[model samples]
Target: MSELTAFLSSNVVFGVWGGLVGLSLLVLAVDLHQKNAHLSPMMKFVWALTVLYSGPIGLGIYFYAGRKEIAHDSIWRRGFRSVAHCYSGCGMGEVLGVILTVGLLSLGNLWVALASFSLAYVFGFGLTMGPLMQEGETFSDAFNDALYSETPSITVMEVVAIGADLLLAGSAHMGQTLFWGALIFSLSLGLFAAYPVNVLLIKWGVKEGMMNPKHTPGNAAPQTA
Candidate 1:
C-alpha cells in the first residue's frame, strides 16, 4: 500500500489520467447500456472496454462510428467492427494474464509472454463461440467456427501487444507509469494491427462483422443499401 502511494505521488500525471479514464468508462458504459441497447452483448462490452482504455478518444469514436446505424456494412466499417469485437476479448485476456503472471507472480519473460498469449486465445475463442452456443449450436460446431474465424485476428493482436509490452516495459514494475502507458500504446497498436487482418477475413467471408442484436446465426437478415 505504501509503495502504491509512493508510485501515485510520483506519477501525478498518470494518476490524474487514470482517474479520467475511469470516469470515461463509467459514462460510456451507461450510455451504451441505456441508449445503444441494439448492440449485441459482446459489442456493448467491447465498446465499454475500448472507452475504458482510450478515454475521450474512444468515446468519440463510439459516437462517430459505433452508434450510427448502418443499413449496409461497408468493408471498412465491417472491418472496424470486426477488429473491435476481437480486441474486446483478446485485450482483456492479455491484460489479465500479464497482470497475473508478470505483475503478481513475477514470472520470467518467456513464461509471461506465453501465459498472455494462451489467455488471449482462450478468451478470444470463447467470445466467438459463446454466442453461437447460446443460440443452440453444439460445442464442437461452435468451437470449430470460433477457431476458424477468430484465430488470425487474435494471433495478430497478441503478437503486437506482447511484443510491444516486452520492448517498452520489460523491466518496469506494475505500478510504474511506463507499464500502463506502454500497455495503452501497445493495445492501440494491436487494434490497428488486427484491423487489416479482420478486413481481409471479412473480404474472404471467413468471419462476420459486428452483428446487430437482432441477428441470429441461422436466420441472419441481409443488409440493405
Candidate 2:
C-alpha cells in the first residue's frame, strides 16, 4: 500500500501517463482531420479505438497500419503489420470488456479479467474474419483463418494487456484519471509484449495484414473507386 502510494505520488508517473494519453489523443485528432486518406466509416471507428488504447504508440500504429495501408512484402515488415491488425480488434474489445466488467458491472477483478479475455478474442476473431470474407472467401474459410490466426495473436495480447491492467487496478486508485491512465499504459505495454508473437505468426504465414481488405489480391481497391 505504501509503495503504491509512493509510486502514484511521484512526478514521473504523472508525466509518463499524461504524455502517453495526450499523444494518443493527438494521433487520433490527426487521423480524424486528415482529408486525403478518406477512410471508411468502419475504419474511422477502428482507428478511433486504436488511438484510444494505443496511447503514444497509437501514432505509429496509425502510420504503419492504417494510414500506410499495411503494405509490406518483406517478412519482418509484414510481422509488424500483422500485429497492428490484431491489435486493433483486441484493443477495442479489451477496453470495452474492462469497462463493462470492471466499471459498469462492478465485478471482482477475476471476473473482469475473464470478461476482458473473452471479449478480446471474440472481437479479434470477428475483425480478422471480416477482411477474408470480403475477399470473396467462404464463411468457413474465413472462420478457419480467424481461428488459426487471430486466436494466438489475441491471446498473447490479452494476457499481457490484462495482466498490466489488473496490476495497476490492484493498486487501489479510485480516481478516474488513474484508471484511464493505467488503461492507456496497458495498451502500450500490450503492443510491445505482443510484438514477438506476431512476428512469429507472420513468419509462419499464420496471419498478416488481413485487417486491410485491400491488401488481399483482387480486392486491392474500393468497389466504387
Give lDDT: candidate 2, residue 114: 90
lDDT of 2 by residue, 41-148 (tens): 556666666666665666666666555354544555556656766778888788888888767777888887898898888888888778679879899998888888
lDDT of 1 by residue, 1-225 (tens): 345433433567577777888888887777766756656666778788777766776676566557644354477777877787788888889899889987889988898799999998998888888889999999999999999999999999999999987777777778777778777767878888898999999899998777543452333355899
Model 2 scores worst on lDDT over the 10 consecutive residues at: 210-219
For TM-score, the strongest prediction is: 1
Candidate 1: give its CA RMSD in angstroms.
5.6
Candidate achieving the largest lDDT? 1
Name the runs in model 1 displaced over 4 angstroms.
1-13, 69-72, 212-225
The C-alpha RMSD of each candidate to the native structure, in angstroms, is 5.6, 5.0
TM-score each candidate.
0.83, 0.74
lDDT of each: 0.78, 0.69
**Model 2 TM-score on a 0 to 1 scale:** 0.74
Q: Which 10 residues in a row give candidate 1 its minimum summed lDDT?
A: 212-221
